[model samples]
Target: MFRFFIIAAEIIILIIVLRSSFVQYLFEDIQNSVSDWLVSVATLPEREELRSLKDKINIRLSPLKPYQQNYVEQITADSASVKRFYHTYCENDDINPNFTGTKRAQLCLIIKQSPVMQVAKRD
Candidate 1:
């Protein structure tokens, strides 16, 4: 019917118009706005007052004098216990690992240990 033909022709024209550069620009602008909103939402809250003194203490021990090493170890042990508490309660291995007193345990908190990194290295 003529009415159907008119409706179909109008829809086709609308589609063609939407495919034009101006409509593409509008679409891209909307996309950029949405992504910017997501970025704002995904950002972590600004760290509270830089960092606490415990976080200031380096977990590494060798370079320090024995007294400093003892102090660092005590602080590290306390922080490690905190890590263990969260790991136990949350039951998320990815959040933190079993914190042994090794250097690797300290580094594990700062680095990505996911198997994906291993795959990337292989390639």
Candidate 2:
């Protein structure tokens, strides 16, 4: 009976710890880190265009200041939308077709992650 009580107490403590805000924050940080890693890996530059694309994306994303995170899920859902936007905004401005496949994929991700980019307009 004593061992049972001890085990029950440990379980209760474990549950409390799991429910704590610190645990929540830890999980959020882990998720963010994983997400960042995925984005970095997917965006790795194989060609020259990708090397400078991040800067260009930041500049484009800047105008949509006071950004919100609510749209990220919706925006990221449709890759075609991102492609159209990239072609319309990024590719047309450039004078060449030097952009690589990886670069284009990364551009789509960058815009999708942007808080202020309109997802509705794409649809």
Candidate 3:
């Protein structure tokens, strides 16, 4: 009975570890996909034109509230900061740079979501 319990405990532990690892992998894959989508959208030529149209529509439909305005400003500031940081550190670097891939993806996500930008358009 003692030996059986020991084996069962070990198997359960192993299963838990494997499940944790799989969950982590899934989360990472989702993040990467979202980051890639955001990067593509941001770089698109039509983005600016669309944004302008959106602004016009919003103006006609409903004015943004103070909270929404603040959110939009924050997002814009965050995006600018991210771009500046990337250009200064990652893009212009001559050395290995040694930045992790995960961090880069995170920065990309921040640029894409732009909480401030979303707030401006909120319903």
Cand. 1 Cα-lDDT: 0.48
Candidate 2 accuracy as lDDT: 0.53
Q: CA lDDT, every prediction?
A: 0.48, 0.53, 0.52
Please provide, for model 1 over 1-123, each residue's C-alpha lDDT reduced to its tens digit, 9 standing for 90 to 100.
Answer: 999999999999999999999999999999999999887666422112112323443433234456654544443343344345335423354432223345434434432232322333466
Candidate numbers sorted by lDDT from highest down? 2, 3, 1
Q: Highest TM-score, which number?
A: 2
Off by over 4 Å in 1: 44-123
- Winner on lDDT between 2 and 3 is 2
Q: Over the stretch 1-123, how does candidate 3's per-residue lDDT look in tens digits?
A: 999999999999988986897888997999999999999887664356335533543354245556544443443334344345445545664232333355444433444454433543463
Q: Model 1 residue 75 lDDT?
A: 33
Q: Which residue pairs in candidate 2 have backbone atoms (N, alpha carbon, C) closer than 3 angstroms, thus clashing?
A: none
Instruction: Note the residue pairs that clash in candidate 1.
Output: none
TM-score of each: 0.38, 0.39, 0.24
Candidate 1 vs candidate 3, lDDT winner: 3
Quick one: how many clashes does candidate 2 have? 0
TM-score of 2: 0.39
Off by over 4 Å in 3: 1-19, 46-123
